[model samples]
Target: MNSDGANDMNLAALLRAGADDELQPDQKAHLDAHLRDHPRDTDRIEFERQLKEACGRVMGPISAPPALRERLIASLDRIAQDNSPRQEASSTAPAPESVRLAQGVESLSEQTRRQSFWNRMTPAVRALAAAILLLVGGLFLLQVVNVGSGNLSLAQAHMSEIATFVGDEHDRCVIDPSRAAKFNISELDAAPALLEEIVGKSISPANLAFGGLAFRDGGRCHVPGKGDSVHLRFDVVDQPGETVSLFIQRVADESDELFESGKSYELQSDNQGRAVFGWAADGLNYFLVAKDEALCESYSIERGLTPNAG
Candidate 1:
């Protein structure tokens, strides 16, 4: 490749890395210098940003069915309450096949004539068929419970990480000039048509200056191991010392169970005196973190995190 082609390729690679937040400190500094000299390179930045946003919405949230969730919760409660080994259900039960046919299922004679073949068949075949069906049913139920438990465990694990990130970004916003409200919401919302078509809502910058809060500064950070996210800082109305900030990122698969897609949750505490909570919409995760719990709740509600927001 020619010199310009090589530079373009290098910049393109940097943009993708920056988009995914996979940039190392030195590489990030390198990208900043390149963008500083090559203003047109800002286009790459925008493209990468939108691409991350679009990807966040790539697959809709997957969650356990309500029935499965309930079963898992019950199982978890049981485990929590009693650490001692309990008798397995099977160990306490009588001959299952006999019990099933004698009580749970109709006897061969009681069954319709079409099923009388069950009686004509060898007892071993009948027992094997019943056992297979029971085994399959048991496996299926265990799978459903496992799926539910696994998802919830994952979502819970992300909570601490979220609290940590929100706190760090809040501190960063306190000093970053870019966190100030400079860009209009329309300009912020100017994303590709494909994104709008897929997501339905404008992926534009929202004017979050409300509820005694004014937009201050904002920036984007690509989280290592996680994904890209948007960060915004806000002044606490007139309370200079107090502050509010938020980040919106692509949700992780494990975190998808945090809510039904589009539902909001109220998060609390990083032990750093910050209150946090969030919701997902159109494939993106939205979180608001602030020192003031009331302020966080206010922003959440204004952003449509209704009365029942989790």
Candidate 2:
């Protein structure tokens, strides 16, 4: 392209990179010069600055309604599974409607993965993605903060909410490893040690047993109005397709009747026969998801993970 065309291209790149903090020194310098030379472009820069500021506020973060976030994360997994090149049994993707939604989310996920890619997109794309997720569970996020400001209680609604959180978290880590890496627990420490510190509770991976699932990885899960909650991933020994994920987080308390009566653990299974158990332990809430029902049942039976608290 000609010099003017090249400069325009650079300007476009600078605009995109500026929003994503990917602007190189030279590119930023060039952008600054160009903006100074052209007052109209300055307005565009201001708009981008504002947009970036907004995205910073509402990302993956606080008090997002469990139901809404889970719905969105499930969309990511189901679409990816459908589109997976490995799924040659059927060449068709999900309905166009679902595909479109998934594409939008995956596209955002991909762009956000790399600073350079995010820096190359137009402001319109960035604004659309940031707004979409930011709006989900926003009201619920506010509510979480509000409740947390007061005493923490496991109200009926909160009980159901935590249940769904565990279920979705299980899928998030297993269904799509790449997506789950967004909140990966990469700290350099043993799983139990990290959990003790991060969640402010004490528990051992050996104690949890996980029904013969070997501990593979562990990390924190973020919820609105909550800090870092540990999510530990495990794989069933010698079982290629079976996986287990456990989430442990500090809670207000479990002395209430909801988690007692020897029926504290709830076993939920899907049509595919996958089952997950959620319960409160002393003070920490735990969700253990089993990917293979047969193996999980055998292990759960062995581990005393009956309908009652273990």
Candidate 3:
């Protein structure tokens, strides 16, 4: 490929990596080179800035509640016990066919005439039929319980991760000047109201059924080589202390692109904090991160946002 073609491909990859929080060192270096060569390309500059900001936004520190952490650990322990060999054997074992048949036959006879054809059948045949019915019923009940447990377990696991990420990691915040200008805010001080508005505008009431909003706040800060940006935060009650952060900015030139097909946003945890989620919409780039990916997903959908799962 020609140099221009390679540059374009590298730039696109960098953009994708920015949204996913998976940008590699080589890719970052390539992007830096291109930015240096095309210093006047505001679009290129903003794109690079936004990508870096997204990374910082997702990697910011988070604080989880101690109670939630204890509960999560306890639940995990319970799950371990429930899955132990002895418990598994008891829960999975089926009643003996003969016993099941006897119980069913007794119940049927008590409800219907003793002289009926069903009643007159040989004891063996009656038992067989009863056993079949009991087996079917038991299987159906088992399936229902299994499905419920699966969903609960998934939610539980996500919650646990969120707790750890927020509690142990997030510390510093990053801002993208070009993007931050759009929100008309200077620092974290502008976060709370903006978060409330975004949640109110983007999140549907239906999505709230799975999880409720816990807290919303905002602030300001500087990132290396970047200017002031707005940081908006939202917390959910069920997830407890898990937060979603949104970073917004405005630029005079058209550099960063808005949400579009094949484009993604993400929040990721850094060494300093837990995971975060981020994306862009309506001239704003957003990062929503928590240790609980499931909760983050729900929040994404509620706010009419898509996750950069890639």
Candidate 4:
């Protein structure tokens, strides 16, 4: 081919590649070669990029609807039969007047046969078929609604849990000093091992980013032996005159049971002054929020954790 023809072919190939991001390696190499030949083709380059972006936007997971698939296959089969040689021959055949009359009678008879077949169907059978169709349709509609509603509900529950957990952390920090002084619990000099036990040794120190931890002069101690539970208390210096306490409990058995399930709950502190937003799933239970009973109640209700609230 001449240089002009070759360039045209190259440009066509590039355009095809640009239209779809799923182009093969060789196709990509060919497009690259075209770009090299036509280095100044800015319009073509932008076109290719836009095409790729458009394709990428739609290149995610997809599942076919079962009923739609079944109906499509049935329609295709009917079309194939209608286009078969026997059907075509019948359509093209020229009939005499008498033959045409006979054909009309046969068509009417065939219609009557179909009507009789339908009429012979038992009421139960007809009802059952209608019920099945309605059920399938209802299920499909339910799935679509759940795709939107279920996700939103789950997300809202998660946010509420996190918010409650943060509030609880703050309140715990505020009241820890009073609790320590009242109980004659040494505000200083607790076991470092206790902190490690509750927070999990696997949790990196880098992950501890609590803002409330700076108050109580940055002190930390562990409370031991509450059935595989660890407790931590620290001061938030930046907040000046506030302390926060964190507790980590390892409920392996409960975690295993809830690993594939979702749960929500309201937690109230012994003092009845702190509330917790709790969500459990996949073996982990998280509680978050301030030290208020009302907040906990609201969190629980919003998360569908409270019975008769959802």
The residue pairs that clash in candidate 2, if any, are 62-224, 63-141, 63-224, 63-225, 185-219
Q: Residue 18, candidate 3: how far off, in angstroms?
A: 51
Please give, for residues 1-310, the per-residue lDDT of candidate 1 as tens digits: 2334334447667877766676767677888888889978778778888877887788656777785576457544433332222223335554454233222111111111222323444666456445543544422210001112113343443543464456655654565645444322222234322223322333433434454666555555543225456665566766877777666665445444344453345544333256665655555666788775545544544454222121
Ranking by TM-score: 2, 1, 3, 4
Model 4 TM-score on a 0 to 1 scale: 0.26
lDDT of 2 by residue, 42-114 (tens): 7787788887778877663578777667788875574464345323443465547644443333332232122
What value does the lDDT take at residue 215 in candidate 4? Answer: 16
TM-scores of the models, in the order given: 0.40, 0.44, 0.29, 0.26
lDDT at 222 for candidate 2?
57
Q: What are the per-residue Cα lDDT tens digits for candidate 3 across 161-277?
A: 332332322322222234333334333334444434543223222322223554354544221112234445555576564555544432112333323322232323222134444
Give per-residue lDDT, candidate 4, residue 160. Answer: 31
lDDT per residue as tens, model 4, 1-310: 2344334455565565455454556666776676678876647767778877877779845778775576457544433432343334576766564444333323322322232222444676446434543544422110001112113333332333333344443454454544343222233333233334443333323232332343122222222212243334455444454344444344355222211223333333323344433444223333434433333333323222211110
Candidate 3 lDDT score relative to the true structure:
0.40
lDDT of each: 0.49, 0.51, 0.40, 0.39
Cα error, candidate 2, residue 266 (Å): 1.9
Clash totals for all models, in order? 13, 5, 42, 21
The candidate scoring highest on lDDT is 2
User: What's model 4's overall lDDT?
Assistant: 0.39
